[model samples]
Target: MSFEASRDKFQAYLTKQGLRVTNQRLAIFDAAFAQKEHFTAEQLLDKARAIDDSVSRATVYRTLPLMTESQILREVDIGSGEKFYLPASGTNSQVAQVVCVDCDKIFEISAPFMEWYGSTVSLKLGLKPITQRLQVSAQCIAQRQTGLCPHRVAK
Candidate 1:
């Protein structure tokens, strides 16, 4: 969705929740939509601060959950133990994630089967799925051969 449409939708959601549309929240929303890739909360805070110094870390933390709850953002776990946020618009509504256990590299895969599966399950359970994410964790062959992966972070 376009920025204006997203803004309007979020505004309606905020209003419905009895939350005021503060400038800090708008700044955070803009920063998040401007991002072309998934981002951690810390990265979101930095981006928001770059846009407006008055956007506090507290605001980012608080607004992020609101955004997620409002369907403006989707929280993803890529096996990093850190929560990442991605826009809920367009292609991001349904996702399949592949995490390399040895390399710690995350790959977002597009699979129509996943979407169908989610829909089928929801129908069977008589539930509606707001968002769907499938995570597949595996060790890559190269990592198996080398006994270590270059991209693996020391945890």
Candidate 2:
């Protein structure tokens, strides 16, 4: 969807959640949607500040959890000692990365592989699957060295 349409949908969703649309929220959301890369809370605040310096760090932190709760953004831990946020655009969702343990390089996959695995487990367990986010970092040298993903190295 176009950015404007997506923004409108987000605003509507927030309204449904009983949140009054504020300039702060829109600026934060706009900064997020404008960038395609994953962003940390500080990074998000930095971007928001670029657009409107009035946006405070605490506000960004506060708004992020709400956004994640609303499913407009998904939180990801890139194994870099910080969590990052990515927009959940339905089919696009949030892209997870496959990191190279040896070189510390990251690779982005089109779709999350874990969602399928989680679904399978949920069916077997007779439980509903709740996938918060998908993150695959190559922090496992053995897996990468063996040419297998860490989550699939044994197989």
Candidate 3:
């Protein structure tokens, strides 16, 4: 969905939840949607503050769950202590995440077969599937061999 549509949805969700659509929240949303790469809460706070100096770390932390729960963002956990988030594509959820263990870089690849696998496995188990995720952790070959990550933008 377009950012405008998602913004409207987010406002509606906030109203439905009896929450006010505050400026800080909107700044956090803008910062999150502006990211082209996966980011952590701390990183989001910095970005939000850049847009609106009044944006607080606490607000960023609180707003993140709202965005994810509303399906405007996708949460990624790579067995690392910090959680990463990226804007939801709003097209397909059947994507696989490949994380570079050396650099903590994340790459998303479309996995159309996941839909079939989810249905097949759920049918055999007599259960309905709601969602599915496949995450692969890999070491950067370049980093391993040359001691440098070619796509290492992660901290």
Best by TM-score: 3
Candidate 3, residue 83: how far the Cα is off, in Å: 0.7
Candidate 1 Cα misplacement greater than 4 A, ranges: 102-105, 119-131, 139-155
Give the alpha carbon lDDT tens digit for every residue of 12-70 in model 2. Answer: 88899888888888899989987785667888898998888889998899889877876
Q: lDDT ranking from best to worst?
A: 3, 1, 2
lDDT winner between 2 and 3, please give it: 3
Q: TM-score for all predictions?
A: 0.77, 0.71, 0.97
Pairs with steric clashes in candidate 2: 99-138
RMSD of 3: 0.9
lDDT by residue (tens digit), candidate 1, 1-155? 77888899899999999999998899899999998767889999999989889999888988998998887788887757888888876654456788787765666777778778988999999998776778899888867787767656543
Model 2 lDDT, full chain set:
0.74
Please write out the lDDT profile of model 3 over residues 1-155, one tens digit for every residue: 89999899889999999999999999999999999999999999999999999998888888999999988999999999999999998887899999999989999999999999999999999998998999999999998899999998845
Q: Superposing all C-alpha atoms, what RMSD in Å does each candidate have to the true structure?
A: 3.4, 7.0, 0.9
Error of 3 at 112 (Å): 0.4
Q: For each candidate, what is the lDDT?
A: 0.83, 0.74, 0.93
Q: Which should have the higher lDDT, number 1 or number 2?
A: 1
